[model samples]
Target: MRLLATAAVITLSSIAVAPALAQTMPVAPSVLPDGTLLDVTATGKTTRVPDLATIRAGVVTQAATAAAALSDNANRMSAVLSALKQAGIQPRDIATANVSLQPQYRYEDNKPPVITGYQATNNVSIRFRNIAKSGAILDALVAQGANQIDGPNLSLDQPDAALDEARVDAVKRAQARAQLYAKAAGLSVSRILTIAEGGEIAGPPPPMPVYRMAAAKAADTQVMPGESDVTVTITVRFLLK
Candidate 1:
């Protein structure tokens, strides 16, 4: 009787440990003896017109003292802002980007660096909803005392529509690639098993600085609205039969 009881306890312990062992096991994919997986690449691109313009303009002033320099910059920037408003730019479209004041230094042989004067700078960022007026607005700003002008970055205001089109193009491209691979391998494509997306190429260009204002060069600036390009790419995995 004692032997029978020990055997029963041993049986129950083995059953409990079996569950733990099964939980610790790793899963492996099942495949046919001669089957193999293949990786393929596809590329797609689409372009659309850009609808917005972004530019940076501001004033730089020099004076005998820091306070004087700052005051001068403030006065000039005020005029520039007023001019932009008169040119039909909404108040919300103009933003102050940077305000800096630094002391000017003079270096001479056998002499320690000395404070010569002070320079102040004020920069404003402007976003033009209408690309047509980009050049005119820049010209007006220059006339109002904006000595530094930075890029008129042309870009799409709403990119969702363009992205949707690009996605469709990417799928078509992937399908073509899968077909080619299937034909080459003597296999037929059954269906797409997985699809992965990559970054879009339709972003705005890097900021451009116009440097000297256009008004300083021409009485009326002429702006050309260059075309913008947008692109997209996708990766697709297809199951073969």
Candidate 2:
């Protein structure tokens, strides 16, 4: 009875070990009889109209002390915000993007730099839903003590439809490439193994013709909003049989 119990224990251990060894084996890709490798890539693109404008404007102030510099920046920014609001900008449309106060430094030969004064900055982001009013709003802000301005990044408010269109185009391109490969190999396209898409919208700033604004009768700062383009690219892989 002792011998039979020992034999049964050995058999059970062997059975458990066999399954683990099998599970450790690596999976290999399927191979065709003719040794033909299947690979294909596709690309697609689409364009979209822009519907929104984002502008970055700010007030920069420098004074003998940090408190004085900050106070000056605050007063100038207040005027700028008021101008934007009077121009029909909503509260949500205006946001304080950044506020920074740093000490100014003056370096002398062979001596450590000394803090001369403090420079304070307050930047605001403005979204112009009404594109037509963008130029006037910018002018008003500048007139109200806003010294720094950057961007007016034009873009579409919603880009879902454009992306969908680009996706379909990409898949179609992948299918066409797969079909070409399969035809050459005397086989046929079977299924899509994988599909991936990545793209970004590019919006360069509109050329701002500088204006002296010496008088109200000065020629208005002419702004021409040319067409904006939305670009999309995708990669797709198809299986051939």
The sequence of per-residue lDDT tens digits that candidate 1 reaches over residues 1-241 is: 0000000000100000001111111222364223333334444455655567778899999999999999989999999999998888997888888999999999999999999999999998898988767777887888889999887766666766766676687788778777777787687777765566654533444434333344546555544545544555555656666
Error of 2 at 240 (Å): 1.9
The alpha-carbon lDDT assigned to residue 40 of candidate 1 equals 44
Predicted model with the maximum TM-score: 1
Question: Candidate 2, residues 1-241: lDDT per residue as tens digits?
Answer: 0000000000100000001111121222464233333434344446655567788999999999999999999999999999998999999988989999999999999999999999999999998887767877888888999999887666556766765665576667667766776786676766755554534333344545344455757545434445644444454445555
Provide the overall lDDT of each model, using Cα atoms, as 2-decimal numbers: 0.65, 0.65
TM-scores for all predictions: 0.76, 0.75
lDDT of 1 at 158: 75
Off by over 4 Å in 1: 1-36, 202-219
